[model samples]
Target chain A: MPATLAEKILQQHCDEQITGPGQIVRCRLSLVLANDITAPLAIKSFKKMGAAGVFDKDKVTIVADHFTPNKDIESAEQVKVCREFAKEMGITHYFEGGNVGVEHALLPELGLVGPGDVVIGADSHTCTYGGLGAFATGMGSTDVAAGMALGETWFKVPPTIQVILTGELRQWVGAKDLMLALIGTIGVSGALYKALEFVGPLASTLSVEGRMTMSNMAIEAGGKVGLFAADDKTLAYAAAHGRKGDKAIAADAGAAYERVVTIDATGMEPQIACPHLPDNVKPVSAVAGLKVDQAVIGSCTNGRIEDLREAAAILKGRKVSKDVRTIILPATPNIWRQALAEGLIETFMDAGCIVGPATCGPCLGGHMGILAGGERAIATTNRNFKGRMGSLESEVYLSGPAAAAAAAIAGEIIDPAKV
Target chain B: MYHGTAHTVGAHIDTDAIIPARFLVTTDPAELGANCMEGLEAGWIKKVKNGDIMVAGENFGCGSSREHAPVALLGAGIPVVIAHSFARIFYRNGFNMGLVLLEIGDDVSKIHDGDELKVDADTGVINNVTTGQTIQCKPVPPFMKGILDKGGLIPYVQDRLAERA
Candidate 1:
């Protein structure tokens, strides 16, 4: 019988008896991850379960990217718990301080996650790895604790939603727009509990970085995961990241899909998710001239080097509108260094943007630059939900890196292609 | 017996609205609960009483995999929730912590803010004591029932570990 990329990757890690969607099965994990905010709770549950130690220290990783530099006493205490637990358990993959990055981006850059692997993280964006053809999903910290102790966890197989992509993307329009348009077209719960497999001619054109950005928003559409086939781009990314694991996994030609949806990207413009919901997408042109108090161009969603390069190309020799605050940080320390080497940092700095250390702060309101009541920001981050980046009355507009950077220069949401 | 009063919210009540990341600095239930729905409704905590039930429309608990969402509700004395549907992660997280969730589909409209409700987990029935209306929910799966019977996933995991030992 033929199987989908999700099915095939899952079966590779579990028993053969697990046939299809909705059937629960036990599967071994290649990696288990938690962040500073989550690791403390997982450690509490691990001790509560009376698990003496982790099943494999190398397979278990904890990152301090969230609220790092210690936002407050409570935040510091949370990381302190993780640090003490890491010391006590002697975990091989405990990353803190300067080594840290956003968990999803940092893991892929370090080659700890790759194609055909079964992975879980305490963060929702864990599904971001599916861009590399890995079968990954987010779990609660208790589930992470269980996977740490048992080296395996249970999954209720999800049916596949095959998204057929066609037509060529226009200039200044990229994967972020394609994904936002899909979410806007399909309601937030359109893919609930389903694996979104991006297939067809247009999908073949997206870069590995673009694909990761697309997959990172799968959760925004309520998808269990968003997946891409392990094509050449996927293999090249795996190799570049130093991963030597099993290479190339794809769906069978006759693979089963629950439903099919088609997206054509021709003549598209940059898309922006309006305040309060990611699915509330509108064209940048529609929202142009909407004043913003700030602009942020990085997160796990769009914090890669390519994303930075896109922003830099737009901001080179330009200045952020003096009224708007622009903050740019790469996803990982390595990515940060790469951006520095490429002078993207200098371009941003020259553009009057605030360059910060690699941290997930400000993206989720942990801090660095938070919005005040009634203010607005155009960001390249995911989720524009209320209070996501600051005060309850503050608003966030989500856009592609190019548009976000352009908005910083314009001091308002603008059509980048036009400007 | 009274299960709790209903604290109703509209559709697509996301995790961030439940417990914002600003309060995620601590995983302590009380700390999280104190700020529960602070973003969505600043006065939400003042409305909830012990053992209250949360009622919402479709896609409640969408966005983010933070289990803190359910923990905050649980800490606010919301031992049960009734919704048209739930985002998948919050559903799993709720069960993992022994917080009962009932899917009433269209029947969720039968519940109004401040309604008195009594819930029966075994039969998946929700009784609106105020309006005298009864709502039958989709039964929680047997395996999940097994987990809830043991108080939560931790104890269930403990049982499995014992069996392996």
Candidate 2:
């Protein structure tokens, strides 16, 4: 049988035989990643392995974004461990929070990821890099330890599942809505272990950011990787990010797909995934006018500067609704600093939005923005599955930054277009 | 590698619920494995038999691409996982760690949580002792089968590299 894009990528990067689905293939990993949360354990594992040095120090990327301020004792210790490990291993691509953001957001921005590359992070959302046309996924500390020691990992090339998104999206609908819609249709496990290749006219309209959002949430719906062929948008994003060569790759037209899923965005309304399950989705109209207590506009998912700019554009000079509190968290300090320089922060403040630290904040519910019991908030973070952000009784509504900003201003679920 | 009958479950056995992110830092697999299904259906983990395979509906290992997930299962002595599908990162992580993943028909719902399933991967027959039913599972390609035979990526790489040297 003819191979699919995933197969071809695996073969190109394969040092030996390619493992089919259900079997294991021991192969060299092209890239390795870890963030604050998993880095401490990975460092410990590396110490036990007693390797002379990393197989290739430059290939390993470390970012400290999860707990930027070194929040408490535990988080500080994590960052301290990561720093010491990086220094000892002579890994040069170390990024602190000021220069870093979410690992998934920063990996592509720095051009460390590209087509056909097999990348792994200590994060579940590491699948987000599949948007860059790479076969990226998440790993555990032991697997990362092995990668650090041997510079390789094993894989089972998954069967492909095609998601054909047809028609155009209705107004105020964004990539988050598209993925949310898929989660609702597929019931979270619908795309399990299968490679989701997004094709059709709607796929073409999505930006790199949009595609990243879609792929970022693939883990939510139980997909292995939500991928798109390296097209102009992929190339453009790479070039703009300073990736000069060999970044773009196209899937062979006749690549085999295990199954094809169809999504019609036409006539589709803005969708909201209620707190506790990305699969528990309803049309925005169904939840409209529901009051909210807080609005969060950041995370690895929608905390990019573009996401902030869009939200800022809608909130300029408008006082936030009295019943709601809007909090904008730039994914990275760099995005935060950039937004500040461009006066976006001022606009947000003028609109009655409270600014937050550059860390994950309310998204992980680590600190800063935990919602009180019965407090309902609309957030732009990934994964609204029950008790994801805070109290199990506290409800979270998930949407894009624009929708979040709009809802914050209205103190209720209102469409961004209406604002 | 070991093999046995299969046990089945519904879709979205997420990593957070599989092995919550909170316990990811420790190096003790036994400790982590003990709490493997703390978030799963209450008392579900105790029902699993030693060496029994797990058949799932879809999106197995769906959240947080944590390797701890597969490690916990392997520590619990699971031999194989057959599903309609797997999450991408979890699939790679599982195979890299040498866990067997079988992608089979969507009709897996017919299999109970603890059905006595005999999976001869080489022959691609999933036999259920209770119902006397046998389902078809796509054969693992030779390349991938080679890795599973060698115990996972580490040992597999050790062998290949030694052979080359």
Candidate 3:
């Protein structure tokens, strides 16, 4: 049977030919991840299984980013468990505290992940690794522990739904626009349990950073993983990051697709997924000029150095709107340090933006920027599902960092192009 | 072990609601389960009982490939989860973690919390022990049944793959 890119990959890694959905196959995962929150659990499970050591120290990556400064005693204690496991397991790519940023961002920046690999993280957004053209998704601690105990996993092969992007994006219509526009067309559950195999000429045009922004939010669209076919651009990105690995591979040109949706970027204006649901998308014009209480620019999705640079450029010399509280959080401490060295931090501070520690705070309602009743904030994070950011009634508008910065200045939904 | 009647929710009960991303930092499944539904419908934890059934809407375990989701639920003593559908990963994770997941159609709405239920694993029938009502759920596939019968996916896979040798 002709199979989609996702099916083809799953079969190759499996011991047999997997035909339909829900057929379990013992397959090999290319990458496995754990952080402070998940590592402790994985380690606990490992102890229960009486596992001697991790299956392959190099395949598993443990990163410490969620509680960078060790927010509380619990977070501080979580980091301790992760560190001890890294030492005991002899893990190769263990990222120590403060040396890393968001687990998703820091991995690629450090050149540890690459194309065609099946990456799994204990964190939900581990799907972010799909930006590298791999089958990366999130998992739980026992699963991570199993991966450590035995460097393999079982998966039910999923069907592939193709997303073809054509036409050039208009000015200020960045990757965030593409994702929001997609969610607009395909409701939140439209792509549920399907692998999003992004294709077409326009897909190639997206910069690595931009592609990461799109793939990071695949969860919001209810897809298992968003995949890119490895090409020259991916290879160049791999080289630029100094990743030493086999060359990446693209999908066969005639790969089968269960469904296909074409997005004309030129037709898309700036978009905003309304609060409470990522698929509740509309043209920014529809929601523009509305009052906003906060604007956040950071997260594994758009909190890269490049994202910071773009945001600082917009925020420089501009005062944050009196009614809007602007917050900037670098994805990782490394990105934070680099931004400070490059003066981006100073530029944001001069613009009256409040900087936050390198953790998922307001994005997941962990802390740092919880909203009050009826408050609304524009953020660059992935999901805006109800109560995802703060108050169930509080609205969260998802966008790129540029739009977030611009909105902070205007105190409403201001298009970056206009700013 | 679970002690009481099962409660049901609609399909697509996502991992974010079952166990939010904020709790991904810790691996202790029990601790994570405590805050599982705080992000979704707060105070849902108090309504559950050990061994209670959870009937849900479509696409249960719909978000994140996180394994903590099923672990949290299983550790919370949720004996079985019946939904219109289950997300691919969560379905696998639940079975792998020894949690029972039944795919019944919209009939899941027929079952409610505090209804004494008797589940026949061999027959795949949920009897409302209190109301004498019965809902049909998909029979567990033989392979998955073997996995569940043996505790979880890892042990099942380990045994099956090892036997092949």
For candidate 3, the chain B TM-score comes to 0.86
Q: lDDT (0-100) at residue A281 of candidate 1?
A: 95
Summarize candidate 3's per-residue lDDT along A234-272 as a digit string, tens digits.
878887878766466666677667889998888677788
TM-score versus the correct structure, for each prediction: 0.98, 0.82, 0.91
- Off-target runs (Cα >4 Å) in candidate 2 are A1-3, A15-28, A47-50, B1-11, B22-60, B69-165
In terms of lDDT, the best-performing candidate is 1
Candidate 2 lDDT over A1-419, as tens digits, reads 45666776677767665545544555567788888877776676666555667778889878887766666776677788889889988997898855777777777877888766887777778888777788877777657867877777766677888888888876667788888888888877766666788888898888888888888888777766778778888888888887777556656687767777898898887788985668888988888899999999988788888888889988988989988878888776668788999999999989988898776657765666777779998999887744456664678898888789889988999878888
- Local accuracy by lDDT, each model: 0.89, 0.76, 0.77
- Sequence-dependent TM-score of model 2: 0.82
Q: How many Å off is the CA of A298 in candidate 1?
A: 0.6
- Return the lDDT, model 1, position A120: 90
Docking class of 3: acceptable
Evaluation by TM-score, superior candidate among 1 and 2: 1
Residues A1-419 of candidate 1: C-alpha lDDT, one tens digit per residue? 79998999999899757688988878999999999888888888899999878888899999999898788998899999999999898999998998998888999999999889899988888999988888889888888888888888888889999998889888778889999999998878988889999999988889988888888999899999999998878888889988775578889999889999998888788999998899999988899999999999889999999999999999999899999999997989999999999999999999999998888898898899799999999999998999999999999999999999889998888888755
lDDT by residue for model 3 over B29-123, one digit each (tens)?
68877776766787787777777777787778875566778878876767678788787668767866767777887777777756777777567
Q: Which candidate's TM-score is highest?
A: 1
